[model samples]
Target: MARSTLLEVMGRHVQANHDTALQCWDGQNKEYIPVSYSLLSQRAFYFGERLVNTTKADQIQGQVIMIACHSPYATLVAFYGAISVGAIPMIFPMPLSLGSHEALTERIKHWGFAFGTPAMLVLEEGLNEKFHSEIPQDIEVIRLSDDPAASTETRSKSANDHQPKSDDIAFFQTTSSSTGDHKAVSISHSNIISNITGIRLAVDMADDERMASWLPLFHDMGLVGAVLFSFCNNYSLFITTPTQFVKRPSLWLKTMHEQQCTIATAPNFGFDYCSRLISEKDRDAMDLSHVKHLFIGAEPIRVSTIQSFLNKFSSCGIDAQVIRPAYGLAESTIITSISSHKKPSDFICVEADSIAIGESIRIVDTLAFSDADLSRYDPSKSVAVCTAGKAIDDMRIDIVDEDGNKIDAPGITGEIAIQGGSVAMGYVWGGEQLVEEFPDQYVRTGDIGVIHNDELYILERIKNIVIRNGENYLVSALEEQLAELLGISHEHIAVFESDIHDPSSDIVVLVERHAPIDEDQINQLLVAMPKEAFPINQILLSRAREIPRTTSGKKRHFYCRKLYQSGDMKFQQAIEVSPQRIMQAQALVNES
Candidate 1:
């Protein structure tokens, strides 16, 4: 059993399944349109060959190519085309609002200028006319619509015809949650192939297994794990937009059941959404008996959320053992550790007070631990669900103290560091000096976690934690506890420190309060909050609608932090307007 390059891996699949139906869409004509693998493969092959042959004309081999497209074919072409030509391909998440558009353009400028002009900008049909207007003078431009039958000749030969070393740089993807100037993580062919192989083995994916995924192609989970993994394994897959899942989560599951999806993975929040959206009527009409590997990842894994999902779906014949809690990041190419299929996994829950106080893990009985403290927690006693699970294949994980000494204990918590064949090359800015962070082989995840009997548990991002008055506060933990106490509904929340510009510093909690409450009620609640859990000096509440969130529904803390610092802050003040006040306001309106 010999492993092949990503390009060759996908090529073999495309060649074998040339006439197999691949893409399906409900068109405006109210009918299903299916595209075969041969169509998609040939389309990308033309563009891929053109990229290489044209690059030789300019003597550029590794210049970056950014693709902005919404069509399924365009996305496939953009990704495989870059891989075929040995150029660094990057994808930009579609900007929603005008605010996001401004932010994305600024990011492109920053990266483009930093990289000394891109090789070629690839735009899909409609965007070529609208967005291509501002292209930098030095960079070349190519449209996906330039030639529909472009790769007919190029599809004849395999990628083996053009030898690309395993170490050749394939592409770069920036952290989607990034703000201001974007930060990119570079991944090579070997990096992706290694991770994909490890992931395939971990999931026990057979050639006949099917995967259903709605995570965005720009996100690592969907791009490398779900999409690329399917291609590498020669498995069929069903993919749709994240917005489609958000609009109708039940549809995602319904389609999966209809397709008899055996393996599927999504962020934990997607499970939560499906749990909330699948009403009694919907549940009664649906059957999800075929879902085997229902993976939960990309965000904090809540035991309660998993339990809720299992409880709700168990009646629909969905097995409780199918709910697998996994952890991963882009630097590792979308898979770090996944739960074992040997048995149903258990979660780790500790006393909240101990964790808040930043104390070492002290395991009491589970029930006793829950009753002892409500705020702070010790990581060691946390439910096993919190563990990222054991390392796979050549991957090695270490929990190191601040002094770089490894802690060899189950209860010991420190920075999570990983070194493996699957680890990425590093971040790319410009020139060859781009990736220095992973100069050796290790990728410092910048995540805080603990190791318990060989299981890695992620506590939170070190950068997201706030330190004030000699106490470390996990803002997310505080938000979670508050949500439990207040009965708030949103899974996404962000807590950021706000400065008063006073000589005496004060910590302000900018919270997106889910429930409506008066300032007095909020203040009272804050005063009564568990001090040992997360100490707070002040409370600033906004409605849940006011919080800035990613398309994936993850809170954008950097945006919220900026909103607090800016004078544009608006608070949802609790006040009931009386009829008299309304009449007065009406009179004022009449006068105006």
Candidate 2:
């Protein structure tokens, strides 16, 4: 019989596998420390035993247990431990260099309240003092440790007696608020297990597959795709924190090279960062020939970024087919669709002007260009959108109109809706919105996408669209064009409307300045932009890291718009372009 719950899966894996381990990178030592499955299971059981002894099983059962830890090992233990004793675990992001401490505290408080004040907060030992006073007094706090004694304790009977049903919520995944406020997505045990099974089949999982990841544990991609996927499959996983990867992008590649990891995952920015920061010498020393699949998701997939990454690492035996463009969200328990491993990624070039709501996109071309060729590609005329491939097993994807009616014809732009076993039960907080969004067992993804060649191609979130003068402009596409024109990373720029509800509102652009640029140079760059496509009224150059971002490195466009409206955004330089200035800039471009 098949396993019904996550606890059963964990028990079966531990009983069958003893050698497979979870390895964590030690940045200081520059090496990975391995923890065997046997030891990990023992520690988890011991932690669960402690929890059950302290609180009644009925009281903790179905209660939220929030985990905030820098160490993947601690997080894994705490996460499984909570589930072992029938508690629902939720991972929270720790403080990062780019994020503020006050912001994190406020977020934790807000989420805690939203989660009905979690029964407990599990934190890393080092962060106890920092977060102790900030946390509510009623919620018990537990500090994680790596004590060997934890593994020596006998498994508690009470912990083993409390088993969660398959339909019971196993964990709560917090959505990355790139467009709006965060909501807790309640994922059941069967939901995640079904997704894992789908992913395994989609990728054609092999017994020898080794995984490496540096994604944060709080994000759904990291928690479900990397950590739990590896654990449930009994695959050897080499893990590290996002801080380590950002500090040295080479380390992620180096670990993959050293371990001969076959499967890896990262966002679009990660691939971009690696391509830009990894030195030539490091690239020469790396051998990624063993890599079978490099899943890229969590943000908009840029064809240029992937092409540049492939070009930079081609000499290291990395094949172009290894790159897989994927699409997923917290609502789907991480993955809804992923590119097939048999062929190279597919992309479609469409006329930018033709992309709008409830309309069929005009196809410009169908091809995947190389990095050298893409450098000459004009973003003003067209945009190349990558296909996220077919839906996974037992999952159905459809394009729906604004009225929630299904659209049959392909290439028509509409909201993407997913119906599958992997879909979460509902949001913990937003019940009313959940009722509207989740209808007929299908979660209406706020993303705007289209069905082409029996595959899903995401364009942009509906919330990210800015309308002016009866024209809709995709913020992400505009950001990409502006970044290319200004010769900067798109991650450093954020473009959004001053008021999404007001069509006449000013279009504001915030660029994080990495180096000093004179006002004339900025003007020249602005002049080069396609005025008919995107007309900027306000531009601000802020200090590095001034623009707010979610923990997953996604720009909080809605939050940034709020900041701009409140006049709270800090900037070193500001430029307000009048209608006369735009006319003059257009005239200069025409004359040149």
Worst lDDT 10-window in candidate 2: 430-439
Which sections of candidate 2 miss by over 4 Å?
Answer: 1-3, 56-58, 115-118, 146-160, 177-182, 369-372, 430-439, 464-592
Query: How many clashes in each candidate?
Result: 24, 0
Residue 199 miss distance in model 2 (angstroms):
1.3
lDDT of each: 0.62, 0.75
Q: Of the candidates shown, which would achieve the greatest TM-score relative to the real structure?
A: 2
Q: After superposition, how far is residue 103 of candidate 2 from its true place, in Å?
A: 2.3
For model 2, residues 170-230, the per-residue Cα lDDT tens digits are 8888664221234578888888888889998997989778999998888888889998888
TM-scores for all predictions: 0.73, 0.78
Error of 1 at 349 (Å): 1.0
Per-residue alpha-carbon lDDT of model 1 for 1-592, expressed as tens digits? 1346667766666667645434443434322245566666666666777776555245345667776665555777777777666667888665541124554465566666566445566776766244555666555666675223434454744332454677777778766432342467888778888888887777575668777777777778878878777766666777776766677787677767777778788776677778888787888776778677887777666655676677788888887667667877777877788777666666556443233112376444332212233234433223323446777776888877655677776676666788887788887655546664585768777666776656666654545544332123456666666566556643534565542111123445555654557645544454445433333445555665667765776675545545665546566553322334434545555564
Q: What RMSD does model 1 have?
A: 11.0
